[model samples]
Target chain A: MGLGKTDKQILAVILAAALALLAFQYFSGHRSQELVLEISRPGAERLRMPVSSLPQGEQGRWHVEGAAGGVYLSYWPDQGVHVDRATCPDQACVKMGFINKAGQSIVCVPNEIIIRLIALEDPAGQGEEELDGVLK
Target chain B: MTAIKGFRGVTKTYMKKAAFVFLCVALSGGLISCGGAERAKVPSFSSTRFLMDTVVTIRLQVIPGNQAGRLGAVAGGGQPAAVPAQEELEQLVLAAFNRMEEIAAKTNRHDPGQGSDLQRLAAQAGDGSWLEVSRDTLFIQEEVERLEQEAAAVLPAAAGLVDTSLGKLIDLWMGVRETKVLPRQEEIEAALALSGMEYIERDWAGGKMRLTLAGMGLDYGAVAKGYAVEEAGRILAQAGPAVYGIIDAGGNIKTIGQKPDGSPWQIGLTDPLKTKELLASIELAPGQVAATSGDYQRYEDIEGRRYHHILSPGEGWPVWYSHSVTAISSGGLKADYYSTLLFLLPAQDALELAESIPDLEAIWVTASGELFATSGIEDYIKWQDKSGYKLRD
Candidate 1:
């Protein structure tokens, strides 16, 4: 009634592989991913940067200059905001970024610049691809 | 062979039954006792009523017996004996009342600034040049003389009005007359200095001019409960690191330390109409103050028309809005004053003021059953019934 040796070996290997996968998922993988955005639009050109790459203390700000004008964008100490200053015809984008919602953008129509905030969890970015089999 | 097999099967069944019974007993006991953690002595907080005044009491969990001695030893002070406790508590309350009085005196406009009546008169009589004095100067001079006489008269009368120091504060508010001129001037100067009102001297008389308080009609009722709480805590804290302590002056309450089992204390805001009913319960940890002011506490029934005690500064009348306002802060005195002030101000303005302060929280229950509270309040405290009060951001 005992199982054959090869069959037992195969089952043991499968169990070991499952445990390894679980360990990998638990220890190193990120439980969450946060996106902090700073965007400044000057005339037609839009300047955007992720907070992760900037120096630790300077992550909440961005400076941009163009032929049309110069502007600065800074994050609010509370929640999210991107304040900008410019001499553009519309000056619309400067008033935007009070939020950084997924797929939302600060648009300066006259300047042809768009500062977008795309959530890292956005399904569209995956485009039907699997991300580490945890989420697709 | 058949008998042997039958005997083995019977034994197996009996063993299984015995195991099941043992398992059931173990599981039932575990469910009841919840495992070796001594049934958390539902550490209690009690309320005592004295002369229409209620004191909420919280008996905290600590290494019991002679805790005062241990605390005394740790703090390098002699153990405060049992007989002296009441006297000491009363003295602390009186001291705090004195400090409030000092603050009030500086804020009072009618007290001639440190000058004798004769000196003030001499300054006014200057070379008999009445025409040289400006109108504003003349008015101020007259105000000083009037205040001097009133101060002499009312100071003695104020001594007999209320039973407790708290009552004294209330009587001052009800009877005293004159804007908080001295305190206001000092506050303005402090505000300009950017040092904030807290850092300014507890007593700062503005312009050194003693303006008499109007008919001695100033009250510190709203602020006194907090003052009492702070005083009580000072005495208690001197004893040792108390896990939890609360002093509820009537409905106004202040809490410190964690609960007996080391959780936060849960405080219920009473429904103004149904005093027994709870509008909301808030969980607070150690070292915080919470004070409530309501229309129902001191309402007047004039021709069957009911009116509450909270009054507006400008019109000297009460403006109805929230049935009650409860403010939480680290300091009891500030929380006490602000709770009454918030009731007098608009909801939006009150919220703005609350936000300006760090570590401050509030719950406003309006006439419409709407509840307005700040964001930090939500995270720090848990609400029992989300139904009665609507949460305004």
Candidate 2:
């Protein structure tokens, strides 16, 4: 059986449309979205802001009043977030360096503060599932 | 013949149109599914608080749709039950945290003024009087006693590895952390002499317990966090199967149930050498818990030697056999106890013991960065980073 020229054109158009739709979905689903830093303290409102909102440079730091004392957090757009200083005795949070990946957190036990990174979109597309918990 | 040819041409045109419609339907269906997948994420509620001297995070996935019938079954009444709203979920997490706080208060031994069960027991030591305490305290003491006896029957040397009566020894070392000065040999010996489960007496029926030795004290530091985590897990479990959650008190993790998709939860293991990097990841079955004991968490350097918090009951000093040990068990207490126990033991003994125990798996990272895991754990563990560690065959 032979098909007319118009029929071949119709088939070609349909195939192209399907391929375009697939390509759009693929790129849109995997595109990286803005990351947010979530700082939570007991008996206080959670502070969430995009990574880009942080000021860049040595002076770009935020102080969070915690249960024990306060913690100073500095951010770098490229290097992620880290605790510059903390009043807690252990200073474990300060020792936990920059954490930019989703599900990673810096916890100050005495201060009762948790700083975590969260992605605005699906983390599964990054080829890793968000960890439920970490055993240290 | 012309009429037949014309009819065939019409049929061919109709077939092409049908193919075009089918392709459009398929394309739209694919897009719709992609949209659905984006919106199919289970609603999650998470809360983090400081409890048991550690950061505890509880995250739960609320089952989709109205669960009135299931709630009625759980409530044991025919009346239609209220949907588990966001506020109810928050309350549920709060309840779990409150229960952990109760356990923490009952087991605290630091402050005598707190009048905690352990503190009261310590103050009444050697008085020849039984002091009443909370049920939580009694249960913890009983479990410690049972574990000690069980370990003695098999491995006598490992019996005192997790002694809760090491309060004096712990206090002595804790002082070292402050002063950065090593305790004299005689001082360590005296503290060790006062540390043993045998010095403690329990009147289980009357809910009373006592320390037979003067100056003897009870420190639930080894087991309290895990016990509190277990208690929190229990509360979450009672919320019914409609909710799957995780209770992470510090690094002691107790998962309530599987994820909404029925896949096992993935728990990351932190490298002791590199505090920030992940050593590996393991898939945990529902209702399972994993705990790790390592020197990296709390340690002090004195005279160029590092002394950690996990003191040996015999030497009354830190054990340096392994860098860290992670244990997986069905209950949080067992996981916590085993992680410490395995850390204290030599690597070979730890692996052997872990294999012998049912429903228990362990991974040991030695000071040299060598990894040894139980046979059962090999199937579940996926090594994430092995740059500095060697996995033994």
Candidate 3:
């Protein structure tokens, strides 16, 4: 039993559409999403906002503020994240510059704010795990 | 006709088996994709708990892709063994910290009459008589005795500068944590007079140690934690050869192995003046132990003056030399002892003294805020903050 001419055309269309979907994903989607800035403050869950969602280099943005008052975090796609503004006395976290590496993190003990860079394979922000550590 | 149908049946069975195999391969691919590219490989794991009177953190690195499904000896193969490598490391690290706690219980001074060996020894030291010790206690006492000889040779203006003999001075200074009062100058002087390694006698053959001075006590403030950290590393190594772990008791950090990727571990050096800022990051190779002692942690602020815990042996007062000192040794005991010495030694003598010692790498940061490293550590340190003090090559 052989396929009819119409059946062959339908199968050809499905194969072409599947290949097109793969190409579209290859070029315009997925890979670029891996760079993310994760903000965590004491007594709250970690908020992993996309680097794109963060207003780039914009100081004093409410979007970056946290639970215990406000701790402003900033990040650029290539540069990484840092505490732009904080209420703490020393401002050591502000002085830490940026930690753009995959496992690097900027911690502010006074305000209990920690911003980490999670550079992973999935741009869609799935399967992200926090590095194991005790903050003293 | 019967033979032809039998052949057809065999052909159909083969086709079904082939389809099932293809489906299984597709499912495996899906599982790999679902796990994420990075997760499919062994990821670094960390855990933090309060141990040894401070926050103790442990980090274990990369379980290579090949070792992903395998569990370490501690976990065993009695259950669903698909536990990720990171999970395996976390469990093993917990075991290591438990070992540290057990050792701490045997030796810690703060827990006096808690049945710790230190408390028992302190009671025995009342009459300056020899007392037998457990194997763990003996190991720590031996290290303490060895450090006393090392410090006496190189450290300046010192007697209780780096030994358990300072137990008296430490007690006077630490006072009752609740009352939080500084001891009178005369009281400190009295404690200092009784402090010196010459007062202690050790008989390794008899497995006993004694304090010759009736009022003097022995403490391993600088040495015991390193021994504990190293012991923990030993336990992890026995469980898994590839386990790369670090036991960081405050500033004392010892690595069990190099990272799986074969790169050195990056350890941040805290700025002596700035309580929270990191002044630099140092890299350590496999089996290296690093420690940083600073004036920041334990200090008394009186009348707008800061008196750090590191006291000079000769002056009977806190030593005013460097704000902090960093030391890395091939082993934990040496690093802990030398780090304390670098902090107490005069700034002018520290750099040269650190260089004279073999198998020891040290960096001293003066109170005036200049960072100086011996030639051994010059290459390993990467300075982060350069405003107050420049990293002099």
For this target, which candidate reaches the highest DockQ against the unseen true structure?
Answer: 2
Ranking by lDDT: 2, 3, 1
In candidate 1, what are the lDDT values of residues A14-43, reduced to their tens digit? Answer: 546545554554443342332424233331
What is the alpha-carbon lDDT for the whole of candidate 3? 0.63
Which model, 1 or 3, shows the larger TM-score? 3
Give me the displacement of residue B105 in model 1, in angstroms: 16
Tens digits of per-residue lDDT for model 1, B1-393: 995455345544464454444444444422333234533222222111121122123222232235534543454556532322333433433443344333333223334574432234234332322223222233333333333343225243211121111212332333322332122334323323321112111112232222122112223344544555565566554424433344544455556444334346555555565543345556565777777778876655555444555654333344587788888877766566557666766666666766766667887878777776877786644333435556665
Give stretches of model 1 more than 4 Å off: A1-136, B1-52, B56-214, B301-305, B381-389
Which CAPRI level is candidate 2?
Answer: incorrect
**What is the per-residue lDDT of model 3 for residues B1-393, given as tens digits with 9 covering 90 to 100?**
995455345544464454444444444423334234432334455444444555455556555544433433324553322333645665677788788888888877776458676666666764857787667777776776666566557654433457667788877777623355667789878988777777766777787767777667667777777777788777766545445566666668777754545456655565667644456556777778887778876777776667777777666677778888888887777888888877888876877777777888887788888888888767866565457886554
lDDT against the true structure, each candidate:
0.44, 0.74, 0.63
* Residues B1-393 of candidate 2: C-alpha lDDT, one tens digit per residue: 995466356656686776666566556634544234433333455555655657566766565544534544465566544445555666777898889889988998774478998888888899899998988998988887776676567667677789899999999988887898889999999998887888888888999888999888999888888888888888887666666777766569888854656567876676677655567768899899898899887789777777999988888889999989988888888888888888999888778777877778998889877987999988778665457888887
User: Candidate 3, after superposition: displacement of residue B153 in Å?
Assistant: 5.0
- Which 10-residue window in model 3 chain A sums to the lowest lDDT? A127-136
Error of 3 at B268 (Å): 0.9
DockQ of 1: 0.01
